[model samples]
Target: MPNYIALDWEQDQLFGIEADVNSGAVRLKRAFNLKWPDDVGTDPSARGQWLGTQLQEHRISASQALVTLPREDAVVRHLELPPCPADELSELVRFQAAIKSTRPIDELLLDYLPVEIADDEVAQSVLMTTVAREQSDSIRQTLESAGLTLASIGLTPVAAAELVVRVEEQQRLDETETSLVVWAHGDRVEISVIKRRSLLFTHSTRLTSTEDTSQHIQTILAEVSRSFVALQKLLPDVSIARGWIIAPNEEAETLAARLQERLSISTVSIPEISVRTIDPLNLSGSATVPIDVPGSHAPYVGPAGILMWASGGRAEFVDFLNPRRPAEVKDTRKLRAIVIAASVAVIIGGGLFWRQSEVAALEKAYLDAKSEQSSLEELQERAAGNVENVTAVQEWVDNRVDWLAKSHDLFNDMNGTERYYLTDLRMTLAGGSGAGNITGNGESKTYGEVITLYQDLGEHPERVVNTHEIPRGKDAEYPFRFELDINLQKPEPIEEPARDDAEDTKTETEEE
Candidate 1:
């Protein structure tokens, strides 16, 4: 929806639709009213209702459109800059424009475009265009009243340049070549030198002296020649390729003839003065020639140019006439901080849950280990009190058996074993004691006594010996108690089983 509405009215209103024929899309949908003698030097509101009514008839919305200021209100200037980085170029242009303009920087909008790129640097020509802030606000208010959105607002000359460039391109003309465009309106003559569709210079002078056609032509030619000369100095080695005279047929012929005689260049007359078809609702019924310059053709070029610029055509020069305001951008640092804080909170919460899970697992393991250890300790204590438990009784019995075996072997192998005999026997298990008495015949008595002592002792070696001994009948009987002491000796090494015998047997069996 690149379509917009352009309104260019100062004296009498002129309206038209500038649509891109290629896409069948509307570039500008507009309506305007001319000022009457009573409305001269007055605000545009004098015919606002009339213009609004016309727009309503044509189904044109004023809110979503762009308005153009009269050429008199805008100051257009060309500026040059040393080749520099693109990012820095805007600031540099603003700084330079501020210094050059008469108004304060805040009161103006600044816009620019690159003209050329040379070497690794950008040699650029800047367009400096400005409108008073008050005037712009008023225009906005008026348009807004009609429910129109003012996408852009600019001056007439810039719009005119835009139209000329489009016509030039549509005609398949070279843009780099200098061309002279003479836009003759009611009382004003807009003379411009365009090089390669880019406006090199513009000069608008009153045509009050047109009463003498010949002199008028001469005066126009002189101004055009001066404009060309100045442009040539700025752009070396360039010449006018053609001359366009936009006026009534008679005026166009006169201007063309004068250009041929003075400039030695071909001249073209554009008779389709109305760049577009007229809207019947807004026009007066008075039978005026459709192709006349002062009637409908005068505003077409400028308005059409504005339409073309709004439609995204290349009009580098127009940018000087309509500088763009900087747009406000949002801050991203605050957004980043918020995101980081949120991420940290999530991490801390997850860590807490993980630590709680580990603690719970360790606590369960500790309780289980403590229970098992307590049960094992209780069993150990019970086993120490009673020998009925097999594991504990076996441990006690094994210790006693080992001692008895050592003592028996020691006594049997001793040199004087007859002098040693068991006097009194007392046996103790791990937690209780047993005392025993024994009687036997002479030769069997001694062995019987030892056997009895060994049996009652329950395999206990220490208990089979006397704990306390004394003579029972005193010195008359000469009573004596004998005790045995035994020391174990190192056992001889046992011989290993013979391997040669097994091998001989295996050989014999194989032979068989």
Candidate 2:
């Protein structure tokens, strides 16, 4: 729902309209044609004041202003180029502008719009427009004095191009066919070539009353034929299949019949003015309409088209005097973005390098720890083997019996007895225990003495136990034989054998 003011400049008067150009629903809020006093151009301030008063009086409220400078003040060029990078294309356009513009490149404000062509084409063309600074300066100054800011400045043909494209889009016309738009304005006819809803070429021709009507029509047709020839040469793939004449219905029908007869192409009468309000404005009333124009109800379609162009129409047009483009601000922002991106890249690189170093140090430390652990495990195994050997030697020493000390004790015990002789002596050592046996024949004065010797030997603390004495009857004069066994430590009591019946009876008789 945004609105814009489109002001058309003529030699003696100014015409304008404020409308909503979005959605192809242009709502005309107000329209006005203000006449300039004869002396108004002499005083610059008087002209600005008059413009401001007219705007206020009509209540034309708009934030953005678009002006169509008189076509005489601008230079237009049609340039073609091969596919190139954007930077190179810009430089090429500047170079071309220097050659094509009458004014020096520095003094001219230049801009261009790409002429839409086929998708598969290798070369692209642009319509370039340039206005001398001095020529636009007065308009800018006047607008500034009137407390207005000029957003865009363009030529009238471009505005007309915008109008044709909008009408085709709203009506849903065939988009692929090449269409010739023959626009009639005042005494001039603007012939434009459109393909895929895009403008490719435009040329202007004027008619005078002195010229024959038929010749004038032929002249217009010849110009169109030449334009078609030029387009076919430039874009060999494209062909003009149809045409639309933007004039009165009668004039359009007559022109259509003549074009079909002469060139064998069908034509439609597409009028310049549209009475259909695509959409209506929120303003109170349509109080002031176009003056002296034939159809009072129909709005001035050209100015409405300009408003549509300003409201971001799809058709391409150059704003040669774009006040919004400030070269210093653009360069500053680009440089700032580059510096920030470089700083971020450097920081990221530094951080990654630092992280890599830390990882390397940690990996080295882990390897060193692994190596030390292996060495400690090997040392532990060797220590365990040494401990086993030491324990085996200790056990061997502890279990060994002192056999020499035991033998000496036995010999010392036997030294105290001389009446007994050791006919045979035997000793055995097993599991750290020792035992000895003795056998001998002893002679005393009587048998009692022998028996007494046996008793005495048995009572010795470290000597004999369980002694047996036997007499060999008249074997020799010393007829007593004895046996004795000795224990190294105190012995458990012996179980005695059972005595026979004869021995028991003999012992009983002796006691009685």
Candidate 3:
């Protein structure tokens, strides 16, 4: 099995644990808990180069590592998800995380561990963990420079919880049995609840110090008590059966004794992975890590837990490299909008091109016409003798109404009507209108014969005829009387079709 490094960091410190991981075994080869080297810089390349130098100098050549986002930089929340199928649970958890998180989901890397999967369509509990993308990116850059391939990302509180479980080394706890695990370093403390080898709740609390002061111990105890109280609300049915704290031998025993005395909770302090009795480390190989190192093992707990998980001490761990996101659904609306926009663009582009062509054609034509224009002086000279007559004879003649043609038609109608002869008639033309009116009064020998003549006169297509009733003449000769006003228009000139020259000549010759 390949070896790896479990790494954890703070603002001014970097801790890495080199381990040879096998199936169900994690052999710690080295532990590096040191201050951050000066002026490593913020950018990835500069940081990576510095990290590579440190790794090379230390001779810790494990190429795989699991790193932690500091407790203060990561967030853990207990959430309830709607009942969903197994395949959809991940998608649901990610969507819920996005909604309940304070920061934008896109800015954070999120992962979730299903704590209790409900069987009867009830809301399920999940521990959702998140870290800022910027923080994880920095770690990634640093590790990449060291030629270390990142395996997973562990949050401080979660890694601490898993370490507590792995150190127990017994049958897994059932759902009802939970443990309260605490790890303190400097002024920060991580409190977590672990059940069934998985984390249920985790939180970070800052403290003044745990430097053998009665007041500091009391403060720590109070924080632990509050953690349990919060857990009651978080998981009302679960209770803490045991407590574990990571510290040195003397400090661990002291804190455990204080917990049992003040809070009446049977707590145990895990000093270190004792080399004499509990030897989990395979120190047989020629290793770079000092086997004779001294000091508190508190700092290594987070990184060691990560190594154990990589070595198959499995539990709910967050890997920011593979974060969760909402379900995959096709955006049909956006697709359709793009298609419609493209079609309209094509039409508008074609119209603009066509308009441009027309404008170009019109401009060329205008230039050509300008080149052909006659000089203004020559145009004025041509206009001198060409002045038009204001009252030309043809102007009067064209608009002249042919009253003779109208009279001929009226006379023909009256010629056949001997009984309906006209007693008086007159015709006059309206100036320049090419139309005239005829007014007449006539008596009829027969009453119906006078109307017959009026109807015949009105049958002409181009004229309008109107009749007025006159009192019947007392003369026994003509009993009915009528008056008519006929409005007449210009007569159309007839265009005779040309006769064949040969046919006309033949007819003349035959006649001769």
What TM-score goes with each of the models? 0.58, 0.56, 0.56
Give the alpha-carbon lDDT of every model. 0.54, 0.62, 0.70
lDDT for model 1 comes to 0.54
- Most accurate candidate by lDDT: 3
User: How do the residues 1-512 of candidate 2 rate in per-residue lDDT, one tens digit apiece?
Assistant: 87777777665777677766665455666677778888777355677778887788878777567787644456667788777776566667788888767678989888776766666667768767778886567777766666677777877666666666666675776676666666554465666777665567666666564345566667777777776676666566665555656554335556766665554531222333221222111112221233333322112445655666655665766677652132342567778888888888888888888888889889999999989988988998988888888886775555444557655755565465554444565554324333334333344335675566656556666454665656554536545565545554434558899889999999999999
Clashes of each: 16, 0, 0
**Per-residue C-alpha lDDT of model 3 across residues 124-191, encoded as one tens digit per residue:** 78887888888878778877877888778878777776665555545444444556676766677777
- lDDT by residue for model 1 over 238-332, one digit each (tens)? 45566667764456766776665556532232222212212211222211222323344555655555655665565664443345434435787
RMSD of 2: 15.8
Error of 2 at 72 (Å): 4.1
When summed lDDT is taken over every stretch of 10 residues in candidate 1, the lowest stretch is 279-288
Q: Please report the TM-score between candidate 1 and the true structure.
A: 0.58
